[model samples]
Target chain A: MSVEHVVSFDRRSFMKVATGVITGVIAATSPLAALVPSRAWAVDLGALTDAQGAALLAMIRTIAPHDALDSAAYALVVAALDKDAAASAAVKSDLLTGITTLGVGFAQSPESARIAQLKAIESSAFFQGVRVKTLLVLYNNPIAFAHFGYEGEAFSKGGYLFRGFNDLKWLPEVPLADSGPMPV
Target chain B: MAQFDLNDDSVAVIIGSGAGGGTMAHELTRRGIKVVLLEAGGRLTPADFSQDPGAAFGQLTWLDPRTQSGTWDAAKTSPNMPAWHCKTLGGTTVHWTAATPRLQRYEMEARSTYGDVPGTSLVDWPIDHSELKRWYVLAEKRMGVTRRHGMPGMPACNNFKVMYAGARKIGYKRVHTNYLAINTKARDGRGGCIQQGFCSQGCKTAAKWSTLYTEIPRAEATGHLDLRTRSFATRIEHDVAGRANAVIYRDSQGNEQRQKARLVCVAGNAIETARLLLLSDSARFPKGLANGSDQVGRNYCHHLTSFIWGVFDQPVYAWRGATLAGVVEDENIHNPTRGFVGGYHLELVALDLPTLPLVGMPYGWGRGFTDLIDNYRNLAGMLINGEDMPQANNRITLSSTGKDANGLPVAHIHCDDHPNDIALRNHARQQGTKMYEAIGARQVVTSPGSVATHQMGTARMSKDPSQGVTNPYGRSHEVPNLFMSDGSVLSTPGAANPTLTIVSLALRQAEHITKEMAAGRV
Candidate 1:
């Protein structure tokens, strides 16, 4: 159970049955994947055509829209999708077809139309596929956590010991009986 | 530390070094008994733990395939991975939140008190609560549990503050940051809780009371405990008279290694323990080892649990402290008026942004789903740990079409909720909502039925040999020299967490075993 062991799971086919868990090894294998011929490895956004990258980014924003994250954070997810698409040509084709069939360009469409289109394509393999892998790349990022008002990284910061761990002001006072010298 | 020779027959061979097995090994070794502890998983040190839940989950979760059946929501939500027990050196204790609640007095005598609840397999423990009280105290002190032995309680994190405010508003009296096996001020050799909030993922600071830092190491220091990790026990070989003589396991090199044993103890969690018993069927005990009553794999219990999240108007930063902070103990007292025989405790559960989506709901989308993640700071969570009734049919059976890496039939867990469990969950839901709404909560969301935190009663204890697999001392009724030192021997699933009870029973079992050994009875 180290990060090394988790990376070892990249070779396990049985472990890839789940949606969210399939996002394994992208961080570890991405650099190596850049070495493979463009025909096999899809590790960079440069490998993805302009329409494919825009459509995937559009899909990711709909999955987890944030007002605060910089364009770089959004670009990180596009890179992740690009990696998956590079590995499977069908994935790229599916993304393109799904975006085309929806008949509303994600970047050009209004918020309501985009939302409605995304909801309609919820059952598609393209949407479900990206939804699982995209979140792993996006939400798990330390940058996204800060933008979303979350303090995700804890163990390395020597934990929240003297931090604002107990600083809550919204709640009312607890009776002394509840906070007794002796445990109940 | 001295390693026991493979041919040595005088040493005790204990399988699966988790809470029960590790504790028993430590106690036995400290008393000058030789013990060879075999663990199926690798050693994941405190240094290996990560702050990220996603990465930590990969490190801690048991990914070995298991097929789940039955009406329980976990069956559908997490079919392949039913219970979230860690397959590591310290077993599930490495991944556990370390919530150690003692069983109430009435919980031990479920059959006598509950009385003929339709469609269930209720039974009383061979031993009572009074018999375990001394051991429980010892376990608490040893683990440095908060609010016990004058150990200061962990500070109330933002999540716990929400729990306290709500519990107080709802007039819940028996509530505080209750018993936790976490360091508050650096007890023993380990440092105090740094408020890492990632105890669920292996504790990197060694602040959690896992055998990895505590018992297993202490046992090794005695030079009487031989700790072998990544050695999977496949069979317990017996002599001509049906007493276990040796254990056949796959070592780290994937080579089969057989170690001679004077006594054998099985603590591979409920599922693996039962499966090992069933797989060890012989001409003498045709059904399985110690399965004369056909009761080895019966009566599996996963506590009826529901995770309730309360979204507030202000930032709560629920994940700022420990994964779990406090408990609401007022509801732990049994009352028949609630239409359930047992009671439940509400414990704090704070999932971060990454896990909230995967576990909070199976598949969520649209603005509502996105909003949940958007307002992650404003949400606080509590989990209901209610006792589930044991049913004879809810069991772990070998799959006909499947086999694992070692060619053993895959374990298929069939869990069906009893009527009492359903009724109790409904009751908890009603009370939980009121408790949250009392403090001006905006909305309450029930997490997807979870992978079981507690699993018990696959190999139950009973005075009668015909009714159970093990005797009062956790010795096998059929196999005199064989034992089960784990939660699998629990007679009934208590509302409280099972680790404390499992450790107490292990201590009691070790005493009985040592005496038996000295008397030449085992």
Candidate 2:
């Protein structure tokens, strides 16, 4: 299957979950009420409560904080965890226990306070699991790709041969003769 | 297209279809020999390959459960997945970054040159250097290696430019894009590389040499090859005369089927090749086939490997070229003054944003680790591929309890770094750090060794039957009709990558087999 197809499918499913969850949670307390106004995203959560999912997203951002990264990139981690939790009861329990152990006000806390809270539980299974999952889901997304300046797949666009495979303007130019003689 | 019957006892059965088996199949078939080729994984075309690292890993990697016990870093980091090889039709060739370097003349005579390093089982290869060189020339020509056959070298990418500047700053002269099997210009019916950079994900353009696109197709065109995909060879059955006459394996549907053979060639990589031999124990030769010396699965060597990443102030765009197109060859000499017996090569490497964070750095959270990810565009990476000492204790053995899907015991890999290996790694790391520092790198991070890609030395070749598993021709000392046509027959692991040598040896072995068959020896 094509990578574009897989990525679009993930985006479609996440949008479906986000619309349903936001509608259901709006009547009660908004789970994103604790997050910063500009950074809050509409996330689709299945096994986690709105509060737990919000706290999980906050925890992932704290683990690998990049101010340039969009909040939607961090939300991908929550969506992936929620999907896994829906399929496996063990995953749901781990996410619930880990979010609860981070204690209340984790989503509302400042960056420094959140970092301090995560440091205490860094050795715990819940923390390690979250750290690994965040690396897998957060960094591989298109939003993260843009923030990090990584050009994804090149074959569809005719590869990088003409585009910038050797376009390093900062480095000194290497002599063509240094590459040795060309084939006859 | 050739369909050999189950009872076609005149056919040569080759197990596994990577560099060794795949090349052997084509060589034998073109010579009008009937062959049955068994592959454990399904066939995949260039269209099936994905540029996504994680998705492609799942698509190509051999994920069979294998246990590991070793002092090597892989035991701690990649515990369950010890060696990284493919299970697909083309085997590891589908996943290899095509750097083809021949073994040095001195490297072939390890025992004489190194002077018997204690705690090691090093031996000189039975075949002389000149004989191997003759085959190396043929292998290079057949694979269309860039530097050897007057083929133009690959164009340097941003990653290679960074490496070139740093290496030059460190006063290393013998540095270039290295000899790659990827076509620089359209040749051998394969297109020239566009430098897409995800080479390990299976070259989508078929520019890089892989048996899947090149050798297997050519062999099938000969109409003398019966290529069986998803046929896992479980045991090499022999008659009372101790000749390997049949192979019992599981078909695509997991049904037990036997394919009779005039002779057998096992090239299932070092791990599985040794396992199959050990599993084929019989009443006549109880120790195992060709294991009277008890050295079937010993002296396992996965080259001393580590990734060194240089975080520069400006963008380097490391992931825009051929993944392993640059090399430093000055260190590939045997100099005891460097505090190591054998030597190493520093090849330019690049991992995508997703894989870089996972395997490129140590496992840690917070700003200290995230900062590396932040400067992903400015990262220049190089990998140390060095020769490691061959120890008798470091080996692959069958697990007593663990069983595969077909109810056969799994291969357990056990390795511990020899003191020489540790010393060589330290020296290489120091030199690598110096290279980057000379070019004013902000920070140099040495990542731990990942899963082994250059695995060798499990079933070694020796002049005497008492010392190793196979003879110089990769033929079993006891089972005359049984041969090994892979990196498993390397008596010692050299500093260079093993693909070119594996293909060369298979080519040489095929000629011998043809001569022997014509002489009515079998």
> What does the lDDT read for residue B293 in candidate 1?
93
Q: Is the docking of candidate 2 incorrect, acceptable, medium or high quality?
A: medium
Residue-level lDDT of model 2, residues B357-429, one tens digit each, is 8777876777888989999999999999999999998999998778899888999999998999999998998
Runs in model 2 lying further than 4 Å from the true structure: A1-41, A109-124, A180-184
Chain B TM-score of predicted candidate 2 relative to the true chain B = 0.99
lDDT of 1 by residue, B116-144 (tens): 99888888888978888989998998888
DockQ of each: 0.35, 0.50
Pairs of colliding residues, candidate 1: A42-A86
Instruction: Give the best candidate by DockQ.
Output: 2
lDDT of 1 at B422: 83
